[model samples]
Target: MSETSWITTPVTADILRGALELERTEHGVLPHRLPAWARAQSPDGQLAMAEAQPSGVRLVFRTRATAVELDTLRTRPAYPGIPPRADGVYDLLVDGRLFGRATGTGGNVLVLDTAAGTAETRPGPVGTVRFGGLPARVKDVEIWLPYNEITELVALRSNAPVESVPPGDRRVWVHHGSSISHGSNAASATTTWPALAASLGGAELVNLGLGGSALLDQFTARTIRGTAADLISLELGINLVNSDVMRLRAFTPAVHGFLDTIREGHPTTPLLVVSPLLCPIHEDTPGPGAADLSTGTLQFRATGDPAERAAGKLTLRVIRAELARIVEQRAADDPNLHHLDGRVLYGDADFAELPLPDGLHPDAATHERIGERFAKLAFGAGGPFAPR
Candidate 1:
């Protein structure tokens, strides 16, 4: 098709969903999971990179166009010696059904070295991903962006004019967690555990799954507090253990403060506190997780001695117990609050059957399993998020 034959539409906030803020850049609009105020408080590189990836962000519009194309500039992270990661995928949904998938050709690369704690960006040209041959009818079309890569929406072109779709009445689910909830190793944006659960449970998802940065930060709590959500979930423990940023002494009060802040805005909202999924490396061991690159593949191992727990070092086991206790104590008067053991979603048995490929992060199949289990446990009848 000729370039001039397509109708170019501006990517505006009204047609976008799932992002906390929209950033206008020189290239185009960038979706940010963290608000500007939150990002400014902590200049941590890891948090900045993770928030820019747009795990659950997507474009929702109503159109009769059979052919659609999206122009985007993506920045994918690459390690020094390890193999380059796969290009991010763009998923097309027609009337809420997965219709097609495509990947951009080229854009930019951020070469990062965790050992050295350094990163360098190499610029490249924008790439176009096209989807053709849609059924001829006015329908709600959603383009789910890559959950892992930093993407800037440059231009959107369709054969026919696209109109913004009004928000639906689905319950809004606001979720915050580590890389697992951030869609790590998931196949695509819509296939992430949270996304899958939202689909099955009939809810709208606002994913606050920032990789390596879910450290019970106050800014994060404030952001979640301000967002409008019918259901709220905070996945804790793994990131705390992996980062070794706190001891048992600090973790206890931090959890309370985080929850306290959220409750200020959502006093009666259905809030569920979830601990880490079963990770043997950090189950009883503390972290400052070490990356094992000796085998030519990326793997993580806990470095802190298990004995340190006696001295107040935090571990997955310790955090889970503390979280349950805190929630139980708070639930006495807060009937709307609840707690769920993450192991219920992915426990030891599940781990033996489907081992984490990298000693962390669930594979695509496990993402599905966790999603289904979450839907059943949290959104099922008598569950925390079950229909009122």
Candidate 2:
């Protein structure tokens, strides 16, 4: 009971490595990308990260409501076609003991029940639930999903102590983007491009990827103003285009408003403004798809004969051009500010290389490609984002 005997060191990699191990399971928990955890389920399968070291911190998956279909993956094309829907209970276990359960149309809610400790749950399409107060030290974690379902589990992350690396060794990267950046179609928790980019760049990530929520709001910009980051990237345009969210007139001012707020706190930090990658659907076209708000479906149709281009539905080209202009104008006074064409990460040329299954976001392999490009371009040894 002596205080000296109770002293504990912070979480470290070595400590975590010695604490937990992942026993691969046929079922994995997918990353939740959309809002309210509703209408956000991707056709792609989910990727779950497992703990190699528990370090007294463990999170495991149990039963899932939707059948865990491995072939049905998001963020990329549906190779062999997307897997069929799953309907059943998938259970998660820790050391063979039930820790949580996911039940819903697409494995919506995860329920965790434990003692003493505190657990935090993030909302999903179904709902979110967490449990605390468990055996601090867990040895094994397991996932049980619908029968015949296989899951691709990504690297596990634990709340365990972090390694005692020097402050300089730790780099913080702040990124702002739409649903895609929020992980709309990525594989799992760690497979998102931002997550992958963070790992490749050796930087801690502050993902400001709000679903249907990245409207360049002043509130969002103000939020970034108060946060600290060593590197930052803003991926704009596509969401605005796809959603047919704004017109040229509104877009220009919104962009300025968003950047001005960030400038308030980060006058010199390296900033990169990225344009949207290519999407033929909205390249230079314009049209309001069958927006059956009643059913929440957007059936795109080519309604703008030839007059639309003459009129403008705010195509991607226009958006990209405006973004370039914004960055260029801002850069005249801010040397730390830079611009990267989102196409550089994934452009029309690469479309054939890695087509989106849903014809929107990049797939897992593409995510990796984009991550690598981001690291090399933004955080490479001699890149503009290198620590100064």
TM-scores for candidates 1 onward, in order: 0.99, 0.59
lDDT of 1 by residue, 252-355 (tens): 99999999999999999999999989999999989989888899898999999999999999999899999999999999999999999999999989999999
Query: What RMSD value applies to candidate 2?
Result: 13.0
Candidate 1 stretches with Cα past 4 Å from truth are 1-4
Best by lDDT: 1
Summarize candidate 2's per-residue lDDT along 163-224 as a digit string, tens digits: 23223455777787865676554544455677667767777666666544556756557667
Model 1 lDDT-worst window of ten: 1-10
Q: Pick by TM-score: which candidate is best?
A: 1
Report the Cα lDDT for candidate 2.
Answer: 0.53
> Which ten-residue region of model 2 has the weakest summed lDDT?
47-56
**Model 2 TM-score, all chains together:** 0.59
